[model samples]
Target: MQRYFIDSNVPESQKISIGIPHYHHIINVMRHVSGDQLIFVFNAGETYIVTIEEVEKETISCHLTERLEKTVELPIDVTLACGLPKGDKLDLIVQKTTELGIFSIQPFEAERSIVKWDEKKETKKRQRLQKIAQEAAEQSHRVHVPEILPLLTSKKLLLELAQYTHVFIADEEEAKINEQKVFKKLLNTMKINDKLLIITGPEGGLSRNEVTSYIEKGAISGSLGPRILRTETAPLYAMAAISYEFEL
Candidate 1:
């Protein structure tokens, strides 16, 4: 069944109305008709099996058939704070990481970052990335879509580190040191419901001073194994490792 995220309230009568893009997707794109079943994820993060009862010119009416109890979210909330990379690397990172169970994404300006997003560009890019996250979440059958946070500078990101239960930074320098398993060790210390922030630098990677500043703010610097990963690849690796550790 096709899945969609809905923002409106699901009334006690169990009857729901959908409009615009979703209506178009159901009627034109997917060619769904009355009696076809689809999954609806509500704002409260509840998933319901809904049956289309009426297909109008602009609206699709659906009735809740069953509420699903299944959850695919990571036990721990993992937020990715990535330094703005060049090109569309952030798009790839958001889509893949959402599938791999990332909770939220934060794009920051790093000391070595080459790409710059002005105010107007930042708003447009955030809107685009948010749509990507929603689509990815639906495709992955996720009950909750990952949030695309506003852009922040490295200094601003440091100030917000206190909100998370734990913070980890992917440092290339750590990869060169043999027998460093800080990532694994940190994972071992994690528990259910913990909120973790994983930070990765852009193409040029984070500077030494930036890493030191992060460490000062209580973030543990770790390597994503011995190999140096690209800006986009690092977060995916971390998400996969987290899924393996906590889900598998």
Candidate 2:
């Protein structure tokens, strides 16, 4: 069954009114008609099996058939703070990490970032990334959609680090020094529901000054493994490691 996230008060009425993109996907792409079955998730993050009852010219009406009882979210909240990379690398990071169960993704200006985000393009870029996250969440059966925040500056990111319970930065220098246990040790120390922020640099990696600044702000600089990973690869590796430790 096709699934869609709908913003509606489902408790008051079982009938759901869907229009535009969803209607187009259902009627045009999926060719769904009255009596066809599909799934819809409401604002409360509850999934429901619904049967198409009416298909009009502009809207599609669906009636709730059953409410699903399932939870596919991670035990702890994870926020991935990535240094803006060249090209569309951030797009891949958001999609894959969302599948791996990230709570949110924050892209920031790094000391070594080669590409810069023009202020005029920020809205379009953010919307595109958000759509990617949404689609990935649906395909991965995630109940909560990962939020894609606007790009932040280094100082702003450092200021926000105080809000998280734990913070780690994937530093190549740390890997070079064979600093292997900090990430795993911190994961072990974290309790359920703790919010973790994992920061990684762009292509050339974060500068010594940037790493030192984040460390001073209470961020633990750690190695993903013995070998250094690419800018886009490190964040995914961190998220997968987190899932391995907490979920499976």
State which candidate has the highest TM-score: 1
**lDDT of model number 2:** 0.86
Separately for all candidates shown, the number of backbone clashes (residues 3 or more apart, or on different chains) is 0, 0
TM-score of each: 0.72, 0.71
Task: Note the Cα lDDT for every prediction shown.
Answer: 0.88, 0.86
Model 1: per-residue Cα lDDT over 43-82, one tens digit each? 7878777889999889998999987765597767999999
- For model 2, how does the per-residue alpha-carbon lDDT over 64-175 read when each residue is reduced to its tens digit? 9877664477667999999999999999999999999999999899988888888878788899999999999999998899998889987789899999999999987878
Among all windows of ten consecutive residues in candidate 1, which has the lowest summed lDDT? 172-181
Highest lDDT: which candidate? 1
Candidate 2: where is the Cα deviation over 4 Å? 1-70, 176-178
